[model samples]
Target: MRSSEGMPFSVVTGALWLDLVYTGGEGDRSCWEALHTPTDVAAWAHSSGVVSDPSAVRIDEADLRAAHRLRETLWDMANRLADGKLPTSDAVAHLNAVAQRADPVPQLVLRSGVLELDRGRNADGAQVLSAIARDAIALLSGPHADRVKRCAATDCALLFVDTSRPGARRWCAMSRCGNRDKARTRRRFEKG
Candidate 1:
């Protein structure tokens, strides 16, 4: 599905990480946009694994609003962490409020001879949002917080955690920002 910015929706960086990157930038030129409708939010929720099934849950405008708020908060928090500063109080408070709305409980179940962990039934929209908020909080406070980085593509504003062994990752996704940057560099050299 397309993002509100008309860009194709991206999930390469991880659901709670940069799924909402499509919603930021300067005004007018900014891609900052909405999910369009509640069904779009529901589809995102399901595709991102925020909910088990899009068909099983009903998302409303309120739910989409909440998700937007949480997504913005997460983006702010991540940028703060990347800049070596604590997130603003408003960001922390928003995350806390959303995180309290749902708690994921893991259950261990035996399947044949192996025991596996399952998160149980699908979460509602609020719970799905909570899960994402909690994940952002964890990333902000966790050891990998230092690894968060914005894309190196001059035109891309997406952020992602550098999980590479050397921590030298530079793009949100190789096929997207990485390839674009490479092509631009190649054109510049060819002109020179």
Candidate 2:
């Protein structure tokens, strides 16, 4: 799913369209994608409360191409959002523009909030992501909602809420990024 250095950065980059930057104050991320294998899809579905993991699933080259296309959609949106907060002046407009310019799958599903789609190797994977989108809207859209977020760790592109005690979490894991930062701080202190 990921290398030692980090995972792919732009997996759910479109979430930036929802103001979910991968880097910010809280240690949240904008997407929750696992590596796309048939087995991985089943595990994800089972974990996410899907009726069952689709063990009967299979993905082909066409599916891989569609996935790559989905990746591109997220990447384009993220790159645009790299400029600032959600494009308030043209949030939907920007999305629309991207939709028009980008490939077909995102264009069809994004508008209707029907993101849980099935086109590639596993129908379960698409369904899983779609479910995630719905859950995200429910969790993040209202006043009592937890703000959606992307991890600032650079390696993790996954989305989550900063549910820490103080809600000041700044990495997906303190033991991971937090420890790294602490070590760097200690190094700096020793140098001084």
Candidate 3:
């Protein structure tokens, strides 16, 4: 959906790990390169909700490489699960290794006189990736594993976690692929 300012909304797949995968786009077409530089990775970390402040996070060339590797591995595994195939043992091992790299240190903070658990602003690239990988582990191994799906649009292969009540979601975003498919179908019917 476009905002009042006429900018399209950012589509989130209900999970940060899946969000990372979508950054690479589908097939030969790329949405945009969000990990081209260490600075870009830092910005993505903040925008993707991996960190609170982009400036506070330290991302280096090595970190960028690691992020790219983890993202591709995750995309492959997610697509496999969506296609009713089991993830390979090697992919599982890589995920485990990334997740064990560095976990974000959680801090209990007092907000409005209530205690809340939060990953504070200060973090490194490895910590950001580990958090994402850890989330992937939980999602792949958890009850919602079967809910993973690729968009039904023939040309769009974005993977998403189907959190609908009936688990019947067929589009990455209704405003995008879903609407396009509906319009195409209507046109075909008119032609008939």
Point to the candidate with the largest TM-score.
Answer: 3
Candidate 2 on 1-192: residue-level lDDT in tens?
233577432232223223223222211222334434445434544543442325534434454333334434444433343333442434334333433321212112343665544322234344434443343344335442443445567664544455455655566555565566788889999999
Global lDDT of each candidate:
0.69, 0.41, 0.81
Order candidates by lDDT, high to low: 3, 1, 2
Give the residue spans of candidate 3 off by over 4 A: 1-9, 25-31, 108-118
TM-score on alpha carbons, each prediction: 0.74, 0.45, 0.83
TM-score of 3: 0.83
RMSD to native, candidate 2: 11.0
Return model 3's CA RMSD, one decimal.
3.8
Error of 1 at 84 (Å): 3.2
Candidate 3 per-residue C-alpha lDDT over 57-176 given as tens digits, one digit per residue, 9 for 90 to 100: 878999989988888888889889989999899999999999986765667889899997666367888888999999999887887888889889888767789877888899888888
Steric collisions counted per model: 0, 13, 0
lDDT score, residue 169, model 2? 55
Cα displacement (angstroms), candidate 1, residue 180, comes to 3.8
